[model samples]
Target: MATISTLSDLYISELKDLWSANDQMARALKKITPQATNAKLSQLLEEAQTGIADHTQLLKALIANQGEEVSKEHCKGMEGLVSEALKHVLEQPPQNGPVLDALIIAQYQRMTHYGITGFGTVAAFANALQMEDDGRQLKDAVDDLYDADELMSELAEAAVNREAAEE
Candidate 1:
């Protein structure tokens, strides 16, 4: 008789899916950089691309560490975010320079919040699973995710808010 083990398998799958989604986001953001009218927005998009790449690499490494084959399930959460961002970009044209920058900043914050929450959830799940090494790695990654969100928030407060308020 053969016994099947399910522990950590679902999480492993989810990690890969998230990795793929982030990789895709990086690629998309690379394309989106040219569309950014504001310099800060453009730089943030570039930073996001780099962050996404790092996340993808870390996720792949984590999956490998677990002795599981890397495979990505479809990530509907990211897809929905992408769709909403695109819709906003298309539908509501900014009235002025400051308004445009604020809109961009708002989109960036929304995306960052999503990533932070998602990563935090995964890290907690890893801890509960008793995968100490995986949990630690994921915890570190989640920290990075939070840092990224804070950076965007800082950029928004320093520049975007000022610009938006001026006009």
Candidate 2:
């Protein structure tokens, strides 16, 4: 018979995955920020820096609260996805209308999607483990990230798509 996974173990594993993904994302965003040209994109990058810093601190606190040290295990899945996105971003730098915007939107979404999954998984684990306070905190962070993702998607549809199609 297959063994059922304990919620505590599941939570710990998911947190480690998220921690790893967040570290990688911080590195990726730092690289991509310099490439952003538009005012909106620049603002997004700056805001992302602040948000990520906050999230990193929170993750550390959570680890400590749980009587564990913050350690990042390798998140191979996220690494591959981030790597592919980075390649695309570098290969197709956004120049003027549409094309650049499309590329920016695509790249931003890739990172955001990874974060959403990681945050959601971690939140689920927290809930299962009956860590209500931790779950709420994680949920708040995830929601903010999700909002950013949604905004990026909207920008792509409203501005990038129309402009790119015309060019």
Candidate 3:
């Protein structure tokens, strides 16, 4: 944890944090994706893992592009979120069915919302520092994360929730 005196320092630091976050979420997803009985939810989790990896690579590349050390500080923020997600869906998970799927959606959204905030904030930081290319790339990552979040919401509203309610 280095002192962040400049906007560039903050931006690069946030990027590293996001990289750690993506890695944590990726590992958590691997543990829980198979717990999803709903095919759609499982599929979404699979796709999200790939996207997270891609975003992690982007974070690394962005840090290197800034001539930074290309290393990540452990993201305690995401550490907590992943902890809660696993506790909710794995440590004491719901039954392996629609109910579980709904719970998974809820937990997944919580993590994604964290990601959305982090990435969006970093994008803004990049723009504030006049790094338009980094800003655009990060904004694109935000969009990808948001799209995944939205699809989970749609899946929940259209199917998972209803099925869980009937359960």
Assess every candidate by TM-score. Answer: 0.83, 0.88, 0.98
lDDT of 1 by residue, 33-90 (tens): 6666778778877877887778878788888877777666677777777666666654
- Candidate 3: how large is its RMSD? 0.8
Give each model's whole-structure lDDT: 0.71, 0.76, 0.93
Which of the numbered candidates is closest to the native, going by highest lDDT? 3
Query: What ordering of candidates by lDDT runs from best to worst?
Result: 3, 2, 1
- lDDT score, residue 76, model 2? 85
Alpha-carbon RMSD of each model: 3.5, 3.1, 0.8
Q: Which pairs of residues collide in model 3? A: none
lDDT of 3 by residue, 63-162 (tens): 9998989899999999999999999888898764898899999989999999999999999999999889999999999999999999999999999999
101-135: candidate 2 lDDT, tens digit per residue: 67766877787788888888888788877899999
Task: Flag the better candidate by lDDT, 2 or 3.
Answer: 3
Please tell me which predicted candidate would have the highest TM-score against the true structure.
3
Q: Give the runs in model 3 whose Cα sits over 4 Å from its true position.
A: none
Estimate the TM-score for candidate 3: 0.98
How many clashes in candidate 1?
Answer: 0
lDDT of 1 at 11: 72
